[model samples]
Target: YIDLYNENHMYWVTADMYFKANQMGLLDPETYTQKNEDYSQKINEGQVFYSSMEWDFDAGNAELSKAGGKDKFVDIPWADTAEFPAWISRASEFGMAARTFVVSSKCDETKMKAIMRLFDFLFSEDGSRTIMNGPKGITWDYDENGVAVLTEDCKQKLKENPDYLLEQGANRYLGLVGQDYDALSATQANEGKYIDLRLNKEYVEENMTDADKDYCDFYGVDVPLEVSTKRENQSTIHEGYINLMPAENPTDIQRSITKISDYLQQAVPDMVFSETQEEYDQKYAQIQAELKNMGYDDVTAYFKEAWENAISNYKELTAK
Candidate 1:
């Protein structure tokens, strides 16, 4: 079939391709058996496959490239057809607004002043550093030239486990209220603060490990992971579908999405391992036909209208 590399089969591709993999006997035993609870743990135990079906764009890309002895890999988009809307090509300079609010009723004169001072510090360079690395001379400190550096002990812990220092209450002053990224979804712990606090690019680079510096040099980025992700997001061609879609989806739409996701989870492995091209195509067609039966047409129509409206709204605001 295609010269696909990663064979872990953990990351999902299309439903048809996945089903074909299972059919062709290409899927790992554990993929069907559900024995491995953690993909990273499986890799650590030497159970890694040849290629990945999907991965996180930031951390996953760099880590995989380094580990797989590959200089680079391209991110391929998933679509039923090659034809896509022109809006997909358009990049917006706008970003999600980081908001702050105050309770006017709760503020006395002194409380109002304190709140104002806090915001003032939060928006400053020093404030950003404080939020990112914590109070100076503790976990992190600045040199004579003002580049942030982690303490020796802090650096040691970071090398052992990425979250070791965080677990020890070092750099924990920022807390949940001040965290920049969504804490629940974030992989790297303290790194999220760099994006939220708008840490200086140079400051971030100064703290990068030698390996990370090499990674940056090869990738043409001046900063480390968190800053790199922020820069990429800023330059992204289109907003993510998740961001544009309704927060509380309609019941039918939710049901359709769940059905499609569940179906693909089971069907993709089989499609990927199909015995022959003819078999693969037959399975593909069957999957597409089945998709329609699973209310895909209704879901697609709903998203089409929603996406068009989102695009229109974005354009209207940008025009202003």
Candidate 2:
């Protein structure tokens, strides 16, 4: 709606970034026609410097290890500016907490209690270790600091064959109790090592490629991930926007919305293609008038109103 992105000006912020790039002649001329896959390919071929969704740390590291790459790529946290506060998008699966469990109405209270016990154990330190690593003594154990550590034999096997962890029966993800196998699983065991043996500091160091070592030195980190760890403060997530869609689904509004979207898909590129900043500004100002004539105001108003109601509803729901 009108206010859908008004509060944060996310709509304009994105436009400004892209348009500024265009004004500077920094954007690729083929930008509008290129697909996400093309972006990924560019990154893999070392033709890209920045792309938010092009790939993650793992993929970048792996792809950049090719013969000519020299492994120059590394994950760095995106810092926020006063004008643009950044946010980390969360995985929808991790947010699906309530959707992960259910029981039949016909189930007895005893069965319900048993199910709860199962959840409790799954969340317990020992159970979490079992779920993430394997039965403790079999694959891992606690050290003097009471942190989870992979047994020497397990480490040796992993060193010899990377797939050894899979054979030891790890990451049966269906049984997780709202968290992943690393932080919580290991943190509960007295804040020792990562529950996933592969993520342990020693294992990671032992298994790191020469490129990983170089990145660690280049970033002044003892481990390659230290860069991200130090910059964790820069990352944040806000769940507010997840359910802010307009509640009403009137066909006419939907049509108007679709029309505006389709128009902007072309109009924005036209604005970016403008040869001069003055021309771009003129096009932008003209767009406001054209959008109003195309029912943009009415559609925005409906969605803005719906967004307000959705916020109110969300507040009430959370309060309960």
Candidate 3:
């Protein structure tokens, strides 16, 4: 949820980043033409300094490895400055579960219990490990010391086959199985190791580059990089609450919302490419006026009222 009713927020999202980008000349003539692969290549070849994690991490590393190894990219926090002392970080929003996971419903208690039990196993440490690797003792097994390790055959397949995970049944039915990274075996025979191979220090040394180490070390982490990093950054998550008061249903305002979306698609570029600071500043007011003319005022009224109601409800719910 967002406070779109506030014009300041609107300005911050729309005009602020681009205005600052323009002032710094970050938007070069070639930016509009750069494709996804082009950006990745540029980052890989060291033509670009900074890139988003999606574009660079794997792509840059593969290219670097081919070039007899080089320093790679890492995910760093957005820098803080005097004017902006705080950063509001949020996790990826949840998507429709029906699309992500298969769902079934039944009134029978027996069937329901069976389903629940299946899910319980699926989410558990051993079950998740089974889904991620393969059948225990076949694909992976306990060593003499009790640490779960990939079998020699599985290791050979992983090295030889690019499609091993899917073709060999590890994550082949990934849509049905959960992908939890849980620690392996709790018994005395077992040493500390993760079911997910990516989290193992040995796996990291053999597969991932030194960049991941730097990223973990930057945050002063001791445990596997992913676990420690996610744990340490939990406090930075700003908002996870559902918006109890939603605006008018999308179907009711689809036309206006669609138009506004289209308008903003063009509006952003126009404002971003403005010739001067004065021109860029006026573009903000112009877009705001145009939005109201396009019935955004009525739309925002719904949000403003909703925001008030939601806040009121929240306070009441939380009251001691």
lDDT of 3 at 23: 72
True-structure lDDT of candidate 2? 0.64
The runs of at least 3 residues in candidate 3 whose Cα sits more than 4 Å from the true structure, single-residue gaps closed, are 5-15, 22-25, 28-48, 53-56, 79-131, 138-175, 178-197, 200-208, 214-219, 222-249, 291-320
Tell me the TM-score of each prediction against the true structure. 0.51, 0.60, 0.59
Put down candidate 2 lDDT per residue, 2-32, tens digits, no spaces: 2432424656556667778877767878778
Model 2: weakest 10-residue lDDT segment is 88-97
What residue runs in model 2 are displaced by over 4 Å at the alpha carbon?
1-49, 54-57, 63-72, 79-100, 104-118, 121-139, 166-177, 180-206, 231-276, 279-320
How many clashes show up per model? Answer: 29, 1, 0
How much lDDT does each candidate structure score? 0.52, 0.64, 0.58
- Candidate 1 residues 1-320, lDDT tens each? 11112232223244445465566675565655554446545544445543444342334445654474443333333232323211212221232222334467866989888887886665444554555555557667655764455666666666666665456554455532233332211222333333232244444665565656776675666764433343322332454332454657799899999999798666755666667778866766677678788987788788788878777777776688
State the displacement of the C-alpha of residue 32, model 1, in Å, after optimal TM-score superposition: 4.8
Over the stretch 158-271, how does candidate 3's per-residue lDDT look in tens digits? 667645655657775445444333333334214445666545666555554465566666766653344333442233221212334563456646677788879987886778
Candidate that beats the other on TM-score, 2 or 3, i.e. the better one: 2
Q: Which ranges of candidate 1 are over 4 A from the true structure?
A: 1-26, 32-38, 49-137, 140-164, 167-244, 313-320
Q: Could you tell me which residue pairs clash in candidate 3? A: none
Q: What 10-residue stretch in candidate 1 is worst by lDDT?
A: 84-93
